[model samples]
Target: MANATRSGNYPPLKNTEHDHAIGPLRTVELHPERRRNTRRFGICGRIAAYLMSIALAAALLPTPIGSETAHANGACRTDDHGIRLTADATGESPHFTSIQFLSASTGRAAGNGFMLGTSDAGCRWQPIYRGKLTFAQMDFVTNSLGYVLAGTSPEGPAMLLRTANGGSSYSPVPNGGNRFARIDFRTATEGFGFTFNDSGAHYTANGGAKWSKLPTPPNTRGLRFFTLEDGWAVTLAPGGYLVKRTTDGGRTWTTRLKASSAVGVGGAVYGAGGRDVWVLLYGGSGMSQTSYSLFHTKDGGASWKQVVSNATAGGGPAPGPAVKAGKLPGPAGRPADMATPDSRAAYLLAGSGAMDKLSLGRTMNGGKTWRNGAAAPGFEGKLTFPAAKSGWLAVTSLTSPAVYATRDGGATWSKTFAIPAD
Candidate 1:
């Protein structure tokens, strides 16, 4: 199962003017009574002391704060964002690690041993399933059909659950001895179950009732399919990474792109219909910062152009290309979560770590122009947008278990719902 508490660390900010790190400054005495020296001063000495006090007070003035959140009465408030979606729904609270929406009003949220369904844009959520199983992966081919991969541990014999009434209930599907680490559906009745590592895969044509062995390219990480016969995969090549395309349902493959910097596909491949597709590629190590590249293809991977690339260390493609010269936004730290609602619109939550403040980068013209804005504190984990202007963010902090929503393309957000108490 996915852990919602997983977060990236924010890098220390640089104060270019002072050539120092930006953080809490040394405490200064502003009140006259708090002064340590008790000796009375002469006329000239009093003037000097008064000037020094003025300088210190000027230094203590607060900087301009971001409009994303506010601090009042010793608490962070999001009142300016909007009204809450609804009061907290009562139920057994499960730590939600992932949330997906079919439309503005229909969706599902899942975590360890539980899943909840909302039909009215999170105004009300009903418990759909509860058990001693961790939902590792979830996919829905339609509003009334979906699947969840569950297992006792992160790795092992996973059980498949199928829901046909919009996640109102689920039933077990026979596994047929196929140990799958993940599953992706290209249609309601056709899908592929991928095993751990690039071992191979299992093919099912009748809604996962039975399966047969399917061959996979070496070092295959995962698969994204637009149809049963048209899909894409990224594999570990000898020198770097290789983007492969398959038109025969994984029966055959073709090399589409080769890169030494990109480690692999970063997140979900989004598209408008099946003609235009966009994917994010990222690489780098924990010890060093990494850059992400966004690629676009309007002819279904026939041709691709790198529209946006983040800057890396040493001015080289640390993982991707160097930042476009004044053409797009620069690095906002590693991409923690991203949502591409369509071919022309995308949102990226960029930050370094879980504790660091995250910035929201939005592009409405296919990465042509990006407006980077501030995100609310503790807004991390899975991010999704059912529409270009409607988005949801699940707060990963255990102490702040709430979900946020955006209606203005992530310019602002409001607390929409909260995980109920046990």
Candidate 2:
């Protein structure tokens, strides 16, 4: 590779500066399991749980599974089946980097120190793994099969871990120091790991027990493959970002999109498959915040459309990714975080979260349109939809780290359980 720049890989697309305007201060020490593998790029290391543990004495008990009891502060609602999410292994706060739902009733959250899994909605949760380091690019292909690219660096090759027991435990997949930015599986036995550094791209025909390199675009930064062969690549340009696609795995490439100034300033690329793809661009300057641009394609990369234009704030720009096209997020925030369950459904988070209320967005018809939606108590910090209208969402705030469920799409959310913090 010629001029490759190191970005991050471990599903590590959350806030780089967790120190800015963080929630109420309460410090806690990290458990011995919290591991720091040496940050590769500019990714901030999650040293310890940001805040001390809140008084979780009342929340540790098992509440009624389906009963919702409104509590004080209008913040802490305890229902039957309520469980708590913790911040990594620190057991301090429940702030998390990634949250994914394998099914409407099953999901997981990755915090600074730990990874927790739930099956009975949010009613209860079990610790899947309690170790050091962060887990990014988390993907659960089935009820029992899952993959996470683990590392300390935000922008570099990360070690890959595989689980055959429904995220109960994860063991490293030997790629020999190969830095994988992301992992995608089209089937149970077929997958691809987009890489950084000299490893290039790889293909695993037998689940990830072994990997083989594929011919990939040089200096590729981000990889989003809809299938084993069909995918999109986010690379670097002189001024902004570059987009590429491959129909035959990484064996070939084609230029499909380009932005001199934006798709978004800090925006990213997301895809549901060959026909549905999105590029979020940031058009803001360095000083103040600005609105973002969303360029989407429902026809592979053959053509692109601008569904969302930019919105500004206070003569500057909004501080985060807000959905200005509708009233879902109001004017407080934009769509900063995104998760696409399929080409028809995509979820967006309203704020740069720590531990508070955030709005949510959902589009049921590709990226052509969106609807104002919300979750109970708080918005989703991390989300996943294993099936249409069937998803598990985790709201990892400092106050109450919990998961919720949406059955008839994202219109209504019910509490599953709360994540336990230290």
Candidate 3:
């Protein structure tokens, strides 16, 4: 993709000298007409030039995945037991990026400033809390306790909100300077939060009451804590990202393997035990295109084998003769490239492009084979599996995005009508 320009309109860096300056100072001064010409042609022209460069980049880069290749065949088919979904309460907009079910009867959904809850198997919904914060990720150790992490902008601080009485109320936690991207709880009393900061992992042993920082290896971007003692951290490197395992809690970690890397690692990391772990990789090779891959570690990242590659499954019709595979592109700019595979079962949501079109895939006996699920109407933002047989999908359509649920895997789906179109 084209490189975003480093222009004055962008937010200033926090530690830079310009951040300390009291009053506005001219970096460059020009006459009125000259300034007009510069504004019209300088930044705007540069942006347009960048777009052209990206188009060229896409043309030069190898096709990450054969666009024409059909979905892999021979994978186990999910039973057709249609799921029955009761229209639970909806939020300000039907666009929900995160959903968690503390149990079969209690759950919460979040997007934008709204958080909604259900108590009767999604039969009815109620507004729990509405604030200015836009939650990007959340996790629940139990129905009564959970945490939500919000993305930070210049207008406000990145927030860590906690609720002790289920979804009845929420209060902000004192996280100091860290901005968390992912949070996981091993138990109601022990939890961990991973941040984009280079410092390390921010952990809490006494629930969310107190937190301590741990030094993370360089280039670490994502983390998954299965239990207080058993967890994994994924770090980006030259070729792919590395997986580190911790058995004695987060006190120390051991390197497993530098799993296959692409532009960047997207989606959630799930571990069945100390022996099994899975991750999703996304983005293109510095080109403005898209590709998706999944990795599996049977012995805790000591070694990894690609369960799915750019190769089309089922040996189906070639997508116009495979374009020669070239070096994978660098990171393409986008969030929600991949969704966490289902913890109870190995399933993931992978999407590409501005449209965010999603494909659902599942691995039954580990990542040995993958079966394609039903096609989503639009971009699939998050996949929440309250039970192994029952799953919920949050997606964005052209007109009105909605949350859908499947009781029998992805065979059939039902929408929650209570969700608003905001």
Candidate 4:
């Protein structure tokens, strides 16, 4: 038999079982025994044998089993059953980057290349969207109205896509905004958009139907808005990070607290409601061995106190291919997150060693006191606490990405859903 060598004439094929089987058949004409047999059979017989071999090889080619319906133009179309992925989805485990809960029983999730919706909290999920676009952030003003930031590839110019029927379908918002790294909507008509490395922001007063440029301070890392004119943001300062408040909207900012540290890199802000809020500071110089500080304020940034002085954040960014074979993948993009249920209760998840090696911390008395909560298994992705005692967590793994619920704060947890690749 002739040795088979792939050429550059066609797209590279994966080394799947079908490839191994079809490879030799395609190159059979080069074999010494087959060449002699072809000469003895004459041209007509040779043609007959060649036709049979072609039929045999065609039968071995794998057929796609995806449930996605085809459009008239041959593009895959999405339906109630989202785009189904093949067995080999990607090189690593599926990683869910963000989760948005509209109510106690309904929510949506965005991951590497897909989005999911759950009507029974995190107990069950339905694939709502799938494609090659990378989801950066998502915001839902109601059960049936939402927005998402996505781009064609990882190096993104994350534009806006609006959904009206609870993400069943989406359409691009005309001149809505572009390259917005994060978006927060305080009401159906009041929303804000911020960029990671720029000075100008965008705001909408009519539920994203139109957008207007809102000048902002440079180097803003995190933001949480309470109203169109009132909000809090974390900005890069000379020493470390500055927690600033903008009562006149983004036009002006007042430093509420200065988190000065030798290793302070950036920070994120989270709000419970009314006057309760938490600020998580990321402190580290490298991707490994991250350290964090948690601050709390009961009077809406009027006064701030450090509740947790120092805690170890195990990882920085998502690990590279050097990670051990079976180890869980790490979280990417945003490093830490906080869920505030009330004026005196909040749960914070931050990187422990890897980006998703998360540790849970709970504070029941606003920010006056905090305690460690039971850590759920797998890499923690996002947290949503609807009440002081009822909360849901999204956890990611290699084979199955799941959702876990906690009824008594974060003291205990139970698996609710293990999302299968569909």
Clashes of 4: 9
Q: What are the TM-scores, per candidate, against the unseen true structure?
A: 0.66, 0.65, 0.64, 0.67
lDDT per prediction?
0.58, 0.55, 0.51, 0.58
Per-residue lDDT for 276 in model 3?
73
What does candidate 1's lDDT look like per residue over 273-321, in tens digits?
3556666666654523446666666665555555555655623353334
- Please write out the lDDT profile of model 2 over residues 1-422, one tens digit for every residue: 01111111111111111110001212222243332321332233332211111112112222455432233353434332343333344344544667776555556766555666655454455566555657665787766667777654333346677765555345667664567766777677678776642225678887666787776676565566666677677666666656788998777888877655533234456866676787665555432323555566766656665444445552233222333333212212445467777776766665434324666656676544555545644433666777778776666565566567778777787775655545
| Candidate 4: 10-residue stretch with minimal lDDT | 17-26
Model 1 weakest lDDT span, ten residues long: 1-10
lDDT of 2: 0.55
The candidate with the higher lDDT, 2 or 4, is: 4
lDDT of 4 by residue, 1-422 (tens): 00111111223322221111100112213134445777788897678656644443232222234312223564422222333433213443456667776556666767766677665544334565555555677787776667777765656588766665555445666445456777777666677776664334688877567788765566777676666677777777776777787878678887777766555466777776336667776665344555555666667656555544443333332211121221221122234567887777877765433433455767566544355544555554678786787787776655456666777888787765555644
* Backbone Cα, N, C clashes tallied per candidate: 6, 51, 12, 9
Model 1 whole-model lDDT (C-alpha atoms): 0.58
Judge candidate 4 against the unseen true structure and give its global Cα lDDT, from 0 to 1: 0.58
> What does the lDDT read for residue 279 in candidate 3?
59
Stretches off by above 4 angstroms in model 4 are 1-93, 175-177, 197-200, 272-275, 285-287, 311-335, 352-357, 419-422
**Which candidate has the top score in lDDT?**
1
List candidate 2 segments past 4 Å from native.
1-94, 110-113, 129-134, 151-158, 196-200, 262-267, 285-290, 313-336, 353-356, 373-380, 420-422
Give lDDT: candidate 1, residue 243: 67
